[model samples]
Target: MNFWYVPWFILPYLLLAFILVKQHKKSNRSNLFFKFIYWSFFYLFIYLGITEIQDKSYFFTIPVLFFVLFSWMYHREKARVLNGFLLNLFIASFGIYLLYNFLITQDVLVFALIFLVGVFVVLVGLFGFVGLMILFYWNALVVIKRESHSLANLLTLILAVVMTIWLIYDSFIAKMLPDWASILLSILPMMFFYFVFAFLNFLSASLLYQFNQPSYDQDFIIVLGAGLVQGTKVSPLLANRIHKAIDFYYQQRKYTRHWVKFIMSGGQGPDEKTAEAIAMKDYALQQGIPEDDILIETNSTTTLENMQYSKEIIDRADIKAPKVIFSSNNYHIFRAGIFARMAQLKAEGIGAKTAFYYLPNAFLREFIAIIAMKRKLHFTIISLLASVLLLLSIIAHFVS
Candidate 1:
């Protein structure tokens, strides 16, 4: 048999391999996710090209390329959980496409009924209907456990309920509503899709930062402050961060001869009698860290300020290109890294453990903050998607 397609198929892979090698060597975290996307598409196109030459019928195997790419990415970076979810979504879409085409080819009536049922089932599963229910119940428990009903605490549950409704309406009632209403509803799904992918990218990037271990030769460790207990003592959340920093400091000392300064960063809230930095610093002193090794940044009211003020202290001390590590709860590590990048500080992150019940809410809060920070890009993309959906709806309405 002739092998005319072999070089064409192999050439792209060779090019992708070269690019991946260069990216790996450059190793910039900012562009790493996009690099992964490029790599995924490279493999996908190769599979499609090979299948096309072999036989058109073999095209059903195209979805397998996505799974293969996901497996490779996961093996390389397990923290890219969102990337796994995204690849799985593509695989699911391919399966749905095959099923729809097969049913339509076999019988139109059967296709309509089966397609409706299948879409409902898949949408329900993808939208996490059952997971949302469980989250709602869990949020209730968390509210009671924490004895606070802050809106932030309820955001995840509220989102789950809203999404469930949106999915149901889009699946079952979109065509039944008035044209304007249908168009608006149609736009919502487009926006939802955009937001889900964007949020996943942010979360994946954040988790990637958390998974990156810092070098042991760091010159500074910045412990970002959470709220204190009655403003006088470190809360469990804050204590965990400080403890992680102390552990890092000791580890650096044990392995390297350089002295690492601990920067306790936080500001005083109105309810607190003392600044968060002072409380963290005191806690560190009690943990037996030397007084000379602890630096206090008492003016930072936010994560960005923590990095900024800590960098100032580092600069003031005349430390040249100080390798730094910032510590926070695991859920907050990614956002801290983002702040560090914004502050133009070269620092890695270390995450302390958090309570199981608190993680979902905390993660949601972080996701919202990330979105806010990139609101311009997100808003523009979302607006464009909504416009496209609305335009398509108008054309379909007129055609019908």
Candidate 2:
């Protein structure tokens, strides 16, 4: 059936346009791009729901409601988290579509769409997480190459935009041209874009890992607690960091005759009877670390507070001024450093290994935290640049 036959689509678009006009007249919000995406999705959902109502096709509405549900539930002030929720919702919608297709008719078109969606979803999801590693490597590359990160980021943005547009165009051409070759058209472009960024990130991370191996020993080593499991026992995630610190302690013992103290730093969470720091200390003792060498800092719940309050405890103990090593997980090291640097603690940021599949959820969480910081200026800059680039690209396309 032709999509134009659905009057619901037409009505929703008209209503969406009116809403945009009203918002534009009433508010100082100049985010036309964001408004466009928001209204587009809003209307598309209404269109789908209305069509499903008229046709009595209840299955199609399930995915639409699911998307709305998850998006609202995960809604935060962070762009990355917002992006992630939307991305995941799209994947969920596509999966639902596949189920609908299988139930209705087992056709090649639906099968192809499913495969194409899978490719794009994998591409986008993998790169979104790996982008952090890219940023890290990009930092090192810029330092050595004496290049500006802003320029590099701009170029990357341009390339991603171009590749996505090309992929869309190529998919249309592939669908139009032939029967057997259409799937190849959809899959190849997405896979290519995904692998291109994936390999770049992998190489960059390798370089970062190689360069970032210069380790140091300090009088005080702070294991920043990853909040407790059920706010009681040390989480396996937090335990990994503690174990790393223990290994470092044993290594120090083997190399030098100096005594080092471990500081388990975190505060009481709402659900916990005791502070996270105390739990970490107990875990350390259970793991065979001597009790005397373990210091518990129970006043910090955040990373910044972890460093700040831990520093005070060390200062009061008259243990040398602020040279410390901090252990968290691998993906967390960069942001942890930002906090450590903010606290002006002389610190080494070390990360324990984490499982691959769980990285997306964790990284999405971190991205949300980062975006909540000084966000207005960052959003303004991003919006301005996106607008300019979009206008330029459109103008170039029209002229050509």
Candidate 3:
């Protein structure tokens, strides 16, 4: 056996990759399926090449290299903010990580084949499962005690306690239970896998969203609103958003002759002394942003409304094809971009820095919110999967 004429097929693969990338750039979100197809073929090509090359490193390096390549492409293409490209990137990265662990630990190969639960254990590493669980519990408690009593923030505490109970039951108590009882309880693991898959993807996408840096050619810096401190003052959290916009404003002017206008988007809450947008404007004014340059939209009660109302203002401002950026806290940007897309606003979001400890808790809430957006579709899939598992369990139960 010898190597020859590999170029005949290899050239077409390269050509297909080019066409897919070009189509994705042209159609953006609507072209997401092309990305999925591209990655599927990409992995297949890698596996097939390994047979010819007889090199195991191709399995590891090729996936990681493609992940980096697409990740760089994702960061550069600000046009498609909420598309499947990011999800594909995460899939490539996760698969590469699992493969790396298998190649290294050898004995770990079996576990890595079983999906994230096994990889989760792999991550536990020298710390061990018990040690990792204890660390999770400690962080959960810290979040619950320090954060507000909102249900969103309390999810960490609830998850920590629930996982602890489930593990205890599965590890020890399940051995003594009747076969059918245990069979029925297997549904929990099924659901656990489903949710863990979702949560991990969300975490990956949220983490990747931060790498987006919009160009200085923007015409509008739309600052999304947050809750006011004591209903009357701009909190540090809100100021961070304003400052991100202001920094971009100055940077745009410094780099080019173009000037950008700020759109302060927020409405009055019941406890607020004034509209949040007005309060944000006051803060920007104090920071030396000209009152004339800032446009206030004080009617948005939610993030979607913020995008919709701001789009209206931009449309009426008589700007042709206005390039815009929306600024919010880092965790909030991904979800807000979803809203921006829904509102048919052609703009990319730019997130500002927020506190570290607050990120995980905030991210949990954002993940839930994004899930809720496609609730009917997601609920149907979850129900279908759960039903399949439950049906299997029932068959075992009846046979027993």
Measured against the true structure, the TM-scores of the candidates, in listed sequence, are 0.69, 0.49, 0.75
* lDDT tens digits, residue span 123-161, model 2: 888887346445544534443353234432344434445
Better of 2 and 3 by TM-score: 3
Q: What total of clashing residue pairs does each candidate reach?
A: 0, 0, 0
Error of 2 at 274 (Å): 1.6
Can you write out model 3's per-residue Cα lDDT over 140-162, one digit (the tens) per residue?
A: 77777777778877766676677
The worst-scoring run of ten residues by lDDT in candidate 3 lies at: 103-112
The C-alpha stretches of model 2 lying farther than 4 A from their native spots are 1-170, 173-216, 320-322, 371-374, 389-400
lDDT of 1 at 195: 69
Query: lDDT per prediction?
Result: 0.73, 0.63, 0.75
Question: Which pairs clash inside model 3?
Answer: none
How far out, in Å, is residue 337 in model 3? 0.3
Judged by lDDT against the true structure, how good is candidate 3?
0.75
Q: Which ranges in model 3 have alpha carbons more than 4 Å from their true place?
A: 1-124, 127-132
